[model samples]
Target: MSEKNERQLRIVGFLCNWCSYGGADTAGVCRFKQPPLLRIIRIPCTGRMDPLFVVKALAQGADGVLVSGCHPKDCHYAVGNFYARRRLELVKRFLPFVGLDPRRFHYTWVSASEGQRWQEVVTEFSAVIQELGPNPGIGADTPMETAGQAASAFA
Candidate 1:
């Protein structure tokens, strides 16, 4: 493979242990060929997700972030995913304000039994990240004014 093809995008997946993570495991057992981009972090529940986690991942050079959990009203912890949905939505919207591409972050729900759905979600999100390319990263050297100007231009 050419260097370009060999270079996999750095994607981070924060998966809820009860559902989405199991779905990913099921996809693996089924031998689904997902893009080898994501580095999965299994969290106890979607409620445990912190917006700073996504921000830190992007700031540290992750190309994209994906947060998957149990379907709404289907959370193993009852309403964990509900809280996740709200927080993740806020983070997704706020990313652009900080000069990051909002498209670089995505969140969804998947159940443990839905192996095929897990494969589809990862494939689709990976393709989207590939299209967006690598994250430019938030730099410390750039003055706040310049960064704000750049953010506006990006908008």
Candidate 2:
């Protein structure tokens, strides 16, 4: 593979233990093809994932972040996914304010049995990031001001 092709995106995924994580594990067991970029971090519930954790992952050089959990009304924690909805909405708004493309982050719901959906999400997310190319923050010392400008442009 060429260097560019070999340049792997570092993605930090926060998956709900009850659903999305299980779905991903099932995908593996079922031998469903998925992008290798994703590095999943399982959480008890989507509600348990703090926005700071997402920010920390970005700061640590992840090219993108994905947060997944049980579908609404399907959370093992009863209503935890609803809480995640509100939190992720705010996160979507704030990431743009911080000069990151809102596209760099994603949130979704997948049931434990949705291995096909899990594969689809990973493949699609990886393709999107590949098209966007490497994160400037990781490859270069992009000033916040510059990133802010880029964000404004994207906006």
Best by TM-score: 1
Q: What is the per-residue lDDT of model 2 for residues 15-106, given as tens digits with 9 covering 90 to 100?
A: 99999999999999999988789998989999877776775676577888999999999889899999889988887786755656768789
Residue 76 alpha-carbon offset, candidate 2, angstroms: 0.9
Output the TM-score of candidate 2: 0.84
TM-score of each: 0.86, 0.84
The Cα error of candidate 2 at residue 123, in Å, is 0.6
- The candidate that wins on lDDT is 1
Full-model lDDT for every candidate:
0.86, 0.81
- Indicate the worst ten consecutive residues by lDDT in candidate 2: 146-155
- Clash totals in order: 0, 0
What is the lDDT, from 0 to 100, of the residue 25 in candidate 1?
Answer: 98
